[model samples]
Target: MTSRIDLTDKAKELIQELTDKHGPLMFYQAGGCCEGTQPQCFEKGGFYPRMNDAMIGLVEGYEFWIDRDLFEYWQFSHFTLDVLDGFGPGGFSLETPLGKTFKIHYRLFSEDELKDLEPVTRY
Candidate 1:
């Protein structure tokens, strides 16, 4: 089945480093304000997910969640998790301390991928 989320090789390497240092990790993106959302990485349970957040899928054995409303807008897209060399906004993401920012790239799924798109869950 076509998964809803994936990681670039560079992202995979960074995630491995983070896991080695932080144990387990998860990613979240919030869509609550005009400033826009910066994807945040937290040690698993470091950040509590709101009741309406959507769990799109896992990358590197970790969950990627988004605001339920945001997921509604991105539901048809495939997400690729990537990273950049900078401190992310808020300084709350685990990667921020390492001078790295986790980023996401999105693309609309092809007609074929849509036919067997992986499922997502909302809490």
Candidate 2:
């Protein structure tokens, strides 16, 4: 089945490095205040998912989840897990000390692709 989210090569490599140090990891993107909008990398199960949050897909063998409210706004798009060079404010992600930040790059799915898009599961 097609995935709703994917990781860049650099993101994969960074995840590998992070996993080596932090063991398994998970990702979350929320729509709350503070660092909510930015994607965050955490040790597996470090962050709890709200009951209605959505599991978009997996990347690098890890789950990628998004807040329910945010998912509604982005449901029509596909997301790529990407990294940026600088640290974002209040970034509590694993990559913060490494001067990197996790981010999302998205594009709207085509009509055809949308019809066969992978399904999302709720937490």
Candidate 3:
């Protein structure tokens, strides 16, 4: 069985607002600076055909999808997503279970990348 991902209150609020304007938000991660570390975020998209054993959780009308592989890599740790003033224009920060953190910036998804995002499943 897959475990569900937890969302912070701030993340839920932001997701709700984004979903209201953009529809279902797709959450995913791809190649990054390192082998395992990569950027992750939510965006508008349709259904995805190829995805790992990820789990989606809906809370207060907000959806959260987490990569099961990545989640397992950070097992025994806690994570939180919060809005921060850094990153010049301000963006979201993902605090990992191992105390590592990454910043998410707004960007346009490439055609290939779009095909990997799983649609937000509402509960």
lDDT for each residue of candidate 3 in 1-123, tens digit (9 for 90 to 100): 222344556656665665576666655443323323343444444434235534444444433344556544543333344433323211232323223333332333445645554343321
Pick by TM-score: 2 or 3, better one: 2
Better model by lDDT: candidate 1 vs candidate 2: 2
lDDT of 2 by residue, 9-101 (tens): 889989999999999999999897999689999999899999999999998989999999999999999999998899976668999999999
Off by over 4 Å in 3: 1-4, 30-39, 44-50, 59-63, 88-123
CA displacement after TM-score superposition, residue 97 of candidate 3 (Å): 27
Ranking by TM-score: 2, 1, 3
The candidates, ranked best first by lDDT, are 2, 1, 3
> Candidate 1: misplaced stretches above 4 Å?
none
User: Model 3 compared with the native: what TM-score?
Assistant: 0.44
Error of 3 at 21 (Å): 2.1
On the 0 to 100 scale, the lDDT of residue 113 in model 1 is 96
The residue pairs that clash in candidate 3, if any, are none
Give candidate 3's root-mean-square deviation (CA, Å).
Answer: 12.3
- Runs in model 2 lying further than 4 Å from the true structure: none
Of the two candidates 1 and 2, the one with more favorable TM-score, higher being better, is 2
Alpha carbon lDDT at 63, candidate 2: 92
| lDDT comparison, 1 vs 3, better candidate | 1
